[model samples]
Target chain A: MESSQNQFSEWLNKQIHSSNSGAFALSPELRATSLSVLDAGVFPNRKNEEWRYTPLREILSQSPVLADKTQINPALIAAFKEAVPNALHLVFVDGEFSNEFSGSISALDKTGLTIEHISTLHGESRKRAEDTIRQSSLSDDNIFQHISLGLSRSGLFIEIQKNHEVDRIVHILHLSTKSESRNFSNPVHVVRVSENSHMQLLEQYASIDAGKALSVPAVYIEVADGAGLDHFKIGLESNQSDHVSNTVVQVASSGVYKSHQYLLGSRLTRANLEVIFSGAGAQASLRGIYLGNADQHLDIRTFMDHAFPHCSSDQHFRGIMNDQSRGVFNGMVLVRRDAQKTDALQSNKNLLLSREARVDTKPQLEIYADDVKCAHGATVGELDKDALFYLQSRGIEKAEAKLMLTRAFAAEITQEIEIETLRSYVQDRISNLLDGVHASNV
Target chain B: MLSIKNLQVSVEDKPILRGLNLEVNPGEIHAIMGPNGSGKSTLAHVLAGREGYRIDGGSAYYKGINLLELAPEIRAREGMFLAFQYPIEIPGVNNTSFLKKALNEIRKHRGEEELDAIDFLDLIKKQMKLVEMKEDLLKRPVNQGFSGGEKKRNEILQMAVLNPLLAILDETDSGLDIDALRIVAGGVNKLRTKDNAFVVITHYQRLLDYIVPDFVHVLSNGQIIKSGNKDLALELEERGYDWLLDKAETRD
Candidate 1:
């Protein structure tokens, strides 16, 4: 494990030393921060409790060269425009902003909302962006967050002003182009919702070709008093890609935050989410679904901290593993002593569709307050025999019966999606994956 | 329409149905009444081809085809319906959608065209009235959160829609009040035809007062100890099973 860390450090040093002048012309603060974190040797190994189930040896064995700015293909841009026509699109190619591919948001500038590239910010906006980065970086102890913060050149910065309601959904699209060698990308995004405001955001990660690639993205969000935000993150990378993302959210007094994540593709994927309630009457809901097949490995880790009284939170996640794939889910809810009247619930359910498929789930609730109501449950099993028999007895074939039961199990999570188009799109993807699982079994 | 000869069934190597025999032709309704653990439900499950039941001996034939050789779904497709004693609650499966799929599958097997959405809705509406089921129940999950009477009525509603040639009512009146029993029995009477038959299994003679079975059989220790007309049910109601058991023991 130590040798693996040394190998990754050597690779990072080589990439930084051999970079061209254009790459070095970016912010020196980010580069210096990334280097110091690398030199500290804080990369996680099997010994770490949080990373025990997920080994990064396979990801680090082959050095991934840092992907530079690349031209966005016209066809890819056209396809994205068609995929989400109603959304305000902000496109990123190889972790850098692509101006020609992004949609114009000038009409939104006069409505007390600001959406700009973080590197192009001046004065107060730049200071706010730096403060957000510093605050989010101070709380995370993982190497992935440090890498994303230090290496990301330019990313999106969105702020919804106080008392304003944003009707249009802001979509951030991260598209990876084809490369001969393994390519690595780091992208960061910051979102701030002011008092009494409402906003919706969708973040999508995708790749064009089946080349080896790695993506590390960091997100920082803050919901002010009496504000509400609905956020969704979708991961649909190519089969040979590896993705790791970290999201940190803070909710203030009487605020509401809801997040939905759909992880459907990639050879190896990890999504770490942390949320904190800083004031009374705040609430949050986190829901996700992940599907894995063949040699894929999918992991989701969440931490919910209730530091104020009269706060509530709920977390529900489901996973489906087929063939020799594996999945892991770990959720922890912590209620401090001062956080009386705190109500939290967590549930993680998984289905193993094949004999070799495996899943590990842990749902933990640590309460230091005597007046809190907390509950957690975890279940890992195959389809219910009684349910399958009931369907078959109604004249449905065995294969079709199994498919219907699987779809119903997944619907419990997908039904929570509020956006109609996104919900249907996810259902169609899940239906296709189920069809593949049926075919492989046959 | 159905014939069983010396049927012997066991669950978990414990004998539950020992050499039970029965016969029923089309256009006949037969009632089998017995005490608890008398294997009345076991006989129904065996006919429906439920697993975990070992047939030590005997044979059952439906329209001259081996009933024991078919799977549960095959039996269902072949116009055999078993109204479960306790309907299984399936969450997330809409009631209407389940009924539509079931009816379409049976129709396809019988060389009939499938019903479209409009036709399915119309058929279910009419059948719902027959069983006195509410329209909102169709939009909810199949039997999930349903009351006891509602589950039984839902079973009868399914029977009205599928219109199977042989319908076996397994204690459908067990957990129902008199009003519910009347409604359910009325639903069965409406669906009865000369080409179809029924075998109603019950523990009380109360259900017979409404459905009016042509023949009544008293089952004891997995065997039919007595067979008579509707009057026999009244006799048992007056004298109870102990008297019948003593008479049978002396005769043996």
Candidate 2:
């Protein structure tokens, strides 16, 4: 395991130095920092507390070529856009932004919103993107994030002007396709919501049916004072795909950040999300659901930093594991001494449907302030027998009954999604996944 | 049309229903009045095919078939319903959809065409009026956050929608106020027909006041001690069960 981990790290480092991908076109200093970090990167092992439940054997055993000039079916892209029909679509095929499939970027001039591809950004927009990326400090900084930073080929930089409210949702779609060699893509997206402005964004990662790819993406978000951002993500990659993402967000005073994530695909996924309270009185509400079947593995780790006073954060996540699948949730809420009167709540509940299915949930709270209020809870259990019998007693078959209870368990979290269509899409995807899972598995 | 003869049941090797015998014909409503620990709920659960009860010595025949051999859902699809005393709360399962699915399953079992969405909504809307259930309750999760009376009413509403042949009311009136009891009994009365039967198990005779039973049986210590007409319920309500127990003891 150690030798393979080291080989994976060395391979990725060589790729970073050799590849000339201008997608995320980072500044010379930041690029150098990423390479240096990658230089010293010994890939995380099982002994690493954060990577204890997750194994990188599948990812480390592969050698993927940087994807370029891949052919995609237009109908497939059109169908994927239906997930968010009314949004401004930015489509990416194998990490490169597709101008033909995406909505016209020049048409958003009247909306006080600037959406530009990283490779095309010139003066100020380029500097703003670099500055945002430089300002983000990831508490769980690892080799993967630097791999995305040093090797990204394409991504977007979105900035909402101060006091402007964008009604339309901005949809960022990353579509992976099958290639001769295993394809690899890392896209770094940066979003900035200015003061008094509001916007909604949907970042979706999917693949052509059964297409094999490796995706490493990084996202940096900034919510200025008095601003609001509703961010949603749905990962529906293929069963042969592997995805790892690092997202860092900073919220200013009086700002609000609401994030909803539905992870329902991928052979293996590790999603790390960190939020820092850069100013006081900021509030963040996060909700997510991950459903895994077969041999798939899904892991979610969240870090909430209460650096200032009077900031509150609430997080709720649920997982449904079936067959031999596995799920992991590790969330930490830290309240600093200066963060007096901070309120934080964290909860992670999981359901294992098969005898071999498993889950590991850890919810931690570290409060240094005496005047703070914090609560954290974690629960892992099977479906309630009483609920199942109740449904069965009403004449529903046992299979249908189990499906109902499982769907309801997920609905508790998915119902919090503000977008109706996206919610339905996510719910349908979940139902489809569960439908393939036989009732006897429960 | 249900028959239980010498039905002996036990829970975890501790006997609960010892030689309990009862018979019900079509169009008749039999009220079985018993004390708290007299195995009334056990009888209801066993008949409804709930798990965990060992049938030590019994023969429960429903429509000439051994009832205990079928699963709970099979029994339900075969026109049996149990209005639970303490209805289970199923969060996230919508009330309307649950009822619709149950009704459709039963309909399919009966070789009838399944009701479409519009038809189901129409049927449920009319049946909701029988229990005086609020329309909004149909959209909420099943029995979740419902008050005691509301939960009882929801059970009755489910009964009305499913329209079972052999319905068992397991202390349905226990948690209801007088008005709610009346509404629930009224719904039961409206659903009764010459082709169906009911076994109303209760701890009090008050519910019999609204839906007068054709027969009243006093159950003590897992067996029926006395059987008579409706006047027997009034007698038990007035004189209590001590005298009846003493009589049964002396007779034994």
Candidate 3:
């Protein structure tokens, strides 16, 4: 299985670098790079620094599910419809787009953002798409990008025109149900927030048993002077899949970027979040809450760079690990030489309920300039025994007290989410997860 | 309804309470007055069943039940209360809710009906006035951010609400001003009853001047060297525990 996955990764890298038809064409160089990374990914010891805590060796041991060429997953689709019925939904089944399960295609143009699929990018409109891909770095160093550019044609893309804000949310649903599939998928969202424009994006990932799902989903946000964007990623993937999700966010002069992630499921799910403060006075907030249980291995690596002066960034993430599950939170904050007075703070706190449950948190700060207010800290432990006794002494049953305190710990991060409905929904999900584990100290 | 027979306690292989015997019938107020390090507070803690205090060679009886065998909460539910000299400061649990839990625990154990929220609030309001504690403090976390006098008053409120048969006030008068001390003493004084007893563990005779113990026992070096009436405390106050200690040492 290891050697097979290696070959597939190598093939993927070759395909990515293969310079092809047009500007939208998959270059050989991109494919070769992805292939090499996946090839090297064969050894559990060689998984990238981001995958250090959550082992991918077990994930690679499973045979890859052949790609599905059929219908979208009804169960996966039903999950979202039950929760977010009003939002527009685009279906991607086994790394292939499905127009049959989609809703309201006209809403994209009407909402002032251009939406397109990767599979059908071979016509006159392909000229515009090709120009953008080559100019942008979405395909850089990513294997999913190579295959997504090569064989896939139905990926989703959204572009917000200059100086306009969308009032509705864009939901991209990835539903897969079959196995042994060549799994190279990319869900790209190009959001151009013109000067003073605003936009909010909701990205959801879900699937059924199939080849390990590699999502090179890239969200390119160009916030012009004075504009703002709020991006939320909700990962409710199937229980039997491996996923790698990348989000590249760029902020311009005086812009604001608020990003949030919720890692709910998947055998092995790793998220690479890169946010750059490209302009002076720009601000960003990256908040995440990962709840893991059983054999789940989830890692979220956040790289935030303060490239200009007077930019501010805050990253506060916490995790709850139960049973034999493992969780990792790696946060890096960098202040460039010229980024003076760049106020930045990062904190990662975790709660391990079971003896086997574990969390490895590393918070790093690299400040090139002095006179900056930058502080980073990480804590991994169970609930306070004294605090627990205090609650138990109050007649609160042991079980109920654990749940309340556990919820209270995560409340600090989830409360700051900009979307009211999203916040409440995530809170409910967290409560249910705690209730299931029976370790959530209320 | 509390009795102690030959209660001796030690820490780090050294005795603190050596062969001390005392008993307080219901409706009576007894004071244990001594200088610093008299093991006055240790006696209160041992009675309350705090962790890590070696009983050495004695047994305490509360309501005819072996008090030492029960855990702190179980003892608490069985009508045994201790007003700690230093009440614990819990940062998140609210004071009102904490007292309510204690009340219900004892009530439930005694086969009595539990107080509902409204009844509980009413009960708390009545007891708060005894210690002059404002409603705001009850709303805050247990003993957290409370002044020293306020913490002492909170302990009394717990005593009043729990209504334990044996209420041991350990150094209750240590950090209070005149006004605060009176409020605290008044609170304890109101709870005096034929079915409940008060053990006022104090350092000076001044608090006894207000609470007015029926019996004063001087504890020095793990032993009760002197036991007398209210006049004994006045004499010790005028002289000091050191003078009494010196007299006892020379005789030994």
Per-residue lDDT tens digits for candidate 2, residues B58-111, read 799999889999988999999999999999998888888888889999999999
User: What's the C-alpha lDDT at position A350 in model 2?
Assistant: 96
Q: List the residue pairs that clash in candidate 2.
A: A23-A153, A23-A154
Interface RMSD of each: 1.3, 0.8, 4.2
lDDT of 1 by residue, A229-345 (tens): 999888888888898889999899999999998898888898999998879999999999889989889999999989899999999999999999999998889999999999999
Worst 10 residues of 3 chain B by lDDT: B89-98
| Chain B TM for prediction 3 | 0.96
* Residue-by-residue lDDT tens digits, candidate 3, A76-167: 56666444556667777765667777775642385576666643444444454444454445312444444444433345555666678777
* TM-scores for chain A over all candidates: 0.94, 0.96, 0.84
By TM-score, the candidates rank as 2, 1, 3
Question: By DockQ, who's the top model here?
Answer: 2
> After superposing candidate 2, which stretches have Cα over 4 Å from the reference?
A19-24, A106-108, A439-442, B247-252
lDDT by residue (A136-161, candidate 2, tens digit) is 98987788889888767678889999
Top candidate when judged by lDDT against the true structure = 2
Task: Report the C-alpha displacement of residue A311, candidate 2, in angstroms.
Answer: 2.4
Model 1 stretches astray by more than 4 angstroms: A2-7, A16-34, A67-84, A106-108, A137-140, B247-252
